[model samples]
Target: MIRLGHGYDIHRLDSRENAGQPIVIAGVRFDGSPGHAPDFELGCVAHSDGDVIYHSVVDAILGALTMPDIGCLFPDNDPRLRGADSSIFMEEAYKRMVARDYRIGNCDVTLICQKPKVNVENDAGESVKQLMRENLSRLLHTPIECLNVKARTHEKVDSVGECRAIECHVVLTLERTA
Candidate 1:
């Protein structure tokens, strides 16, 4: 049996007071990049670590399996979730996938951002897309080849284009491993 799922997430970007780090996507810290402006860089405004990739991926998996979404599993009103890591949400989805004897056959992720170019190598010599692919593959126990990540600018049209927000969309094929 095979299942298909799609997920999307977006967060408003704002200036964080005295935040030393850069925006995090799929657990990668992006700082001082060809897309980062130290003086004007923006950060995601959310209760938890705002990782649009991980958040959307989790939702995709859960939605595919006919389960509750991240918001339902980890409600924003929960005080314990304040500033929580997004990876935990991914973990929960993975556990459910395994319990249901399903595995990711393949997934494609698209990210939209005006700053922090995804293909450009940051100061760490790692391209943001590659870093995200590796991180998500590791977290989901899916082969790296089964994942594809692409990013683009919002063409300066809306909040994303203005660099005031970031968004991600994910689609995946889930196959029965049994």
Candidate 2:
């Protein structure tokens, strides 16, 4: 059997955490500096690390399994979850996916942001999209070849395009291994 899931998440980049607070996407940090830096003067207004990539992936995994989403399983109201690392949420989702006997056949992610382009390499000489693919593949135990990440801009038409927010959309196919 095959199952398909789709997930989307968006978060504001201001009015909460100040800029230069570190904008973590997928698992990489784009921080420091001011106008010269990517995601300059922007920070996600979220209780967790505000990694839209991971959050969307988790939601996709849960949706494919017909289970509760990230919000339900990890409520934002919980004080313990404040400043939580999003990878923990992703690991739990992966565990659930495995428990249900499903493995990723293909995972595609589209990251929308006006700043801090996802195509550029970080200070560590790692390409953002490749790093994200690697991270997701590692977390889900799927071959890196099975995953693809694409970067996009909102065309200066919305909040994401304005650099006030970041958004991500994920679609994945789960195939039964047994």
Output the number of the lDDT-best candidate: 1
Residues 30-60, candidate 1, lDDT per residue (tens digit)?
Answer: 5554532223366668878888999999999
lDDT of each: 0.84, 0.83
Task: Provide the TM-score for each candidate, comma-separated.
Answer: 0.91, 0.91
TM-score of 2: 0.91
Candidate 1 residue 72 C-alpha distance from true site, Å: 0.3
Each candidate: RMSD: 3.0, 3.1
Clashes of 1: 0
